[model samples]
Target: MNERLRFVDPTALMHLSRGLTFNPLRSAEVLDDVLAAFDEKNGYVSDVQAWVRGGGLQNGPCPTLPSGRIVADVTETMNAERKVLHAAAILKLEREAGIAPGVFLSMVSPTLDVGMRVELPMRALLKGNLPLEGTYTVYLHVLMTSDGRDLVYYGITKRGWSLRFQEHTRSAISRESHRLFARTLRDLTAARARELHGVLDERPKLRGLITTICATGLCHGEALDVEEAMVEKYSLASKHANGLNMIPGGAAGLRAAQRFKGTH
Candidate 1:
């Protein structure tokens, strides 16, 4: 009865309407009412009412309703209803929260991994949400010796893992000092340098040696925390023979060399 009309995605509304076909005569009216309810409540509804109206429950006792439907049938019906509601919810969120549809879809999907989730804020930024800037993960890239016995380098980037890797390769091949990883590899012993050179020279080889260890969907401070933790845990320093990290992690990495003298 609340007359507040909330915006709903047309596609999502269509999906919800299609899902109500079991009771065709009242489907249109039910869909209208459902939309109205969502609108009035800022796009949310009571779970029990949603289930009942979504065909997971029906009238009558005994063999007419509860006794007539098997567990699998009820579960299937409930799942179908849930999908419709989820789609509607996502659409509502998109409209009200200004969330990009792709980002909402990724959040609703069941299989999104940590890396993908961590990338959502960046996606939002690309979609013109400037407020999310500097809050996404600064992913860590670990490159290890061919035998995987030791880590060869530790890298962190807010740009992207693949882009940073390409930069490392380019800087190494061009003998440029822009990328510390490439510079470190270039400074290693001949045999070790050649091994890493071959790896960086080939895209597939470079990718194979790289692994993303920690990805977080937190602010820059959290990302720095993760980077520092990884650096300490992995001992990514020149003192570690196999480590290729030129300096310590986080802001400390940017300090002048004088500060770390005789500190080990």
Candidate 2:
């Protein structure tokens, strides 16, 4: 649960109630009618024009005057001029008021809806598990051997770093030769290299030799651009160094290389 949960201000509610000149006897009914309308729209934008038109929310003919209808009308007016509100607050209000989660979420905006989905895993991660749902810097998993040289066995994923780390470890341990990283390990083994020899003998221990570099966030087109940049920067195009990249970064890198080749 978010500790920062906020509710609709009483002052705002009171002002709205007054604008509708709601009947004291049927205040609940009026509130219900107005809320139902909002629920129908999954909550409108703060500046929604449709809400200002004063349509919908009529329950039926009543002998005790149309106080509920008036309240609905007032709500529409207030909603049109009201500032934007977070969907979480509205959801919290509905929950506290004994409304079902299904109904509350059903009317939430698409953005808020995605946020709600993202929130669950994020909260769980904050409690000491691997994190989720945030912009992450893609990185390179480079192995530094006993010698001064390094070998990049895997490119980091744009998704969760920890999750990707686990995936690499799992794939390497399982000796999935089809995977690029695993294929690199096989190649290194076959070469009988002394410097980083037996590096992949115990795949789990490889994590210690591997260092994750270039952690970044939310800029330069996020991880994809960064990953491509790193790949190009460290590429052993004509060098004697060993790199595990099967593909040459992204499409942009390929295009740039092609242009260079054409000019030369």
How do the predictions measure up, each by TM-score? Answer: 0.38, 0.35
* Candidate lDDT (C-alpha), each: 0.37, 0.36
For residues 83-200, what per-residue lDDT tens digits would candidate 2 score against the true structure? 4322222233322332112111112222111111111111111112222234444545554433445567435444544456556656755777475656554444333232244334
Best prediction by lDDT: 1
Clashes, model 2:
1
- What lDDT, from 0 to 1, does candidate 1 have? 0.37
Residue pairs in candidate 2 whose N, alpha carbon or C atoms collide under 3 angstroms: 42-107
